[model samples]
Target: MAAFEGAANPSEAIESGYYVHAPGKLLVDNISNRIALRPSSSHLLLGGIGSGKTTQLLVACQQINEIEDIHAIYVDVSRYTDISKITTGVLTAITGLELAKLIKDSQDKNVIESIKLIRNLAHGYTTEYDPYDDFYDDGGQYIAVKGIIPKKTEGYGISLQLVETVSKLAKATFENYGNLVLLFDGLDRLDDAKAFMQVVYSDAKSISSSGIGVVLIGSLTAIYGDYHDTVDKSLDYLCYQPFFDVENDPEAYNFFEEIIQTRSSEDFIEEAAIKALIRFSGGVLRDFITLTQASIEETYLSGEDKVQEQQVLKAVDSIGRNQLLGISDNELKIIKQILKTRIFIPRTDEDLRLLVRRVILEYRYPKLRYAVHPAIKPLIQQILD
Candidate 1:
């Protein structure tokens, strides 16, 4: 993990969603097309980790802020896995510039009182706040408060906190700025993708009617394949994966180049090596970077200072054994389910999709298929026994 400190190339920062370069243009294009007429559409930007989801989202936030007089918040699902953390993060993001900008002279008692009242609507506030009580349900639909969320010991109140914050920011921003947009990210990295989607689906109607625009980003595999598979469900019914029909729906090669192009060593990463890396990584951006990083370090340790195609292949092999491929008992079940469909043959790309779907469902399980996952051939046969 530490081997690729400088990251062997320039594009690593791009992979981590910092200094967004490649995907920023594409994402901004999508937003432009959306904002032309609708201005905002609740989109579930799906991609594997390091697939530029969060980077694209942050790009969206920064870009959208420039377009409309808006109130926006971003919910990071990693920490906000439970209800409490969710509420807190949502509320915190939603408060937006409202605290320091609007309400006027916040140092003054009246402004502080106003902020306190607003804060009460959020989870942690001890003061009394019930939307049904003093607030009128006149012009727009009266937003009902979800009730007070207790402070969490670990990850409990996060979700609640996030929603509360987003709601307040949306309402307040609309009152002052005339438009609001809230983005929820990191739903893919949660403990249960299905549960996260459940929260989203349950809230979708309300989110649509709330007079606030929202853009959600997560992995389609997590939302549709992984958690849903455990319950015996199909992906078609959930939030439509926008680019499902595109031939390279996963866009692995493009995504690899997308991240790689942004890094400092554009000239150093040879085209052949990039192709090999993409093919080896099965097109996931995260895998590409990890593999690249691994390969670069391997070359360095082997006395070569540059990235070579052969070095990339060795790196890919090492990455597979060291990281990309691992299978747990639960994941073995998923792999077995996929194997049931694939007939245990590495004949076609469709088979690869099934395998990838299962792999995506659970990284814990040994993901290396008999043909794809490098090495451990003797190891898996030994374990399966």
Candidate 2:
């Protein structure tokens, strides 16, 4: 049987059959207006795992690139640095590599030489300098170099040096390409949401003032928590990438059906089975796709012509059991309480953790709502009983 596995990342999703238009277009329009009126703009794109935040960032980048007057530089921060242990020094090194790649590819002798000079001055830090011998090829693309910056550096001096280099590159890029926009993704992987906010709060002004627009992806907690106002004030816009509207929207169901058809026969999955999978996913795209994939396997193994209700239930039970195995007793208790009330207000790290782990799902359409993952409801009741 052909399985309906969803995209693992935005790039793959963009080239796949199930790609849909998200709210990122609004962000692109906002940035376009800002660019026409001002020298630079900085903003935030916030969402939970599988909420299509990365897809939104990719959409923004693709739309920005379509503009004749702007050159967009997309950087996946987690690729060059460790989010769990990132610090100012490490951030600088990673940011510098993205800047340096653009500069080197521009082939402007003056900018290239200036970067070399900055690299020499910043050589005292843990960031290494790999010259043309390693990065350049006949194809004329300046391939990026990847390495981690040592956590225990001599001092904070490296941060200053890296910042200076990035500023120079941003200025040069704008001079050559009319305008510049930096789209940063993968910072949400950081363990502490506050650190993600702190980094953006500290650097938003410099990046914007340098004539470089910024679109950063951050943790949902930092976007919706008490510090949300602070985040709102720090950037041009703090936008939330929403989950699917499965509960109240007919269009949502059609979208899921189309996704299944793209990878398999239209009749491969029963209509009742599809609805059950959607309800179980609670509108989280990743969970829905994953459960659908599991159901396909279960049906194929059972020699059924099409997926049935029993096979869908088996898939849901399997996923639910896996999720329950990962949480602590206290976390489970918090989730049980949320199930009892069908309400969740983020007040502590535990609350944030529950949302992050997908033990609790969030919905904004029709009204704000939170509930235990639908697939795990049976397991939760078992515990309570």
Candidate 3:
């Protein structure tokens, strides 16, 4: 049961012997070591969904927390706020919330006031001002007095206030805990590339200038086409976690095998079943875990003690069918073309969606290549034939 839990906490995964140390750890080490040397450095982690990005972020946080004179805070943005509505202000407020908790007992009046303001703003309460009071009645109409207009708490005002609040919190953290490094886990879920870029452009400088280290998980959109140049120039480093190249890398294949064997014994699942699960997983960790769990259920339903290749195949086919539920005929044609030719050149909105949905898997081993999800391969082949 524990073995097949797809998105286990990095610490829990490590403690329970479910964590696999492969090439992915290189990313964790790079971020951790850089933050240890310079606490104010900024880093961006780019990966697709189910690429173990959250796990990598948490592990790097754990490693950075161990370094002397450094403190790491892991913030799962999705856990605390709606990612669809995320903005620079919201991110600043949530980060302030975490910093406030770290220095809850601080007696600094400025820090305390900032904490109260952040709490109020996060709860949708803003400073009140009556614009109507500034208007004067002129016989037939209301006229605005030019010199006495009240300023509303929005736009530039809110941005300045939030920046000041985060600065104060960062100062307090340094005084109490030496240095602060924030590891953000959920910004990658933002579907709008422009919105994500806005956050990076608006807040990355402010946070770095305040002497706070940052490691943010970003979506693939940031690394594709036009957005890539801007993102590459904005951050101190950009680390990518691509799908494990199991087809060409023996070590990567062995890593998946160890992940499954750690959860269930060989006696419970046959070797061929494990191989089939790996092949159909498309080198994605989450898919591999899901397939393993489904195969276990298939065996249980059939009154069998050990999972066989047939059971694994049945589980994959069922999951594949579900994957195609909402796909349109046009999308099907696109997928069919990719499957038949085994080449994917991302050029349009539909291509990006397919990449995001994991219908198309990108691999960068001997050379960059794309392929259809192996679980759904047979069905597409049937349609073609």
Give the TM-score comparing model 3 with the true structure, all chains together.
0.89
Q: Which stretches of candidate 2 lie over 4 Å from their true place?
A: 1-3, 22-39, 89-93, 105-109, 117-160, 224-226
In angstroms, give how far residue 70 of model 2 lies from its true place.
1.1
lDDT of 3 at 287: 87
Q: lDDT of all predictions, in order shown? A: 0.48, 0.71, 0.79
Cα lDDT tens digits, model 1, 1-385, are 3323433322344445445344223654575346434543455565444444665666667667677555455555444334424432332333332333454443556445545544554433333345466555444443444433334442223344345444554554466666656666766554445555554554443454445566666544443454544322321112321211111334434645665665536566778876676666654445555777777777778887567798887765555455425455654544454434633543343443434442332221123222323222233334456
Model 2 worst lDDT window (10 residues): 146-155
- Model 2 C-alpha lDDT per residue in residues 113-155, reported as the tens digit of each score: 7577555443332443444565545444333332335333232
Residue pairs with colliding backbones in model 3 are: none
* Clash totals in order: 33, 0, 0
Ranking of predictions according to lDDT: 3, 2, 1
Q: Write the per-residue lDDT of candidate 3 for residues 1-385, one digit (tens) a residue.
A: 6668665665677777777777544789989998878888989998878888888887888899899999999888877756776765555666778888988887878878877766655554433344455443333343322110012322222267677777888887888788898888889889999878877766676677778888889998997745887786678989988888788888889989888878887678898998999999989888888888889899999999899999999999998988767777777899888866877898887888888888888887656888888988888778667
- Compare the candidates by TM-score and give the number of the best one: 3
The superposed Cα distance between candidate 3 and the true structure at residue 207, in angstroms, equals 1.4
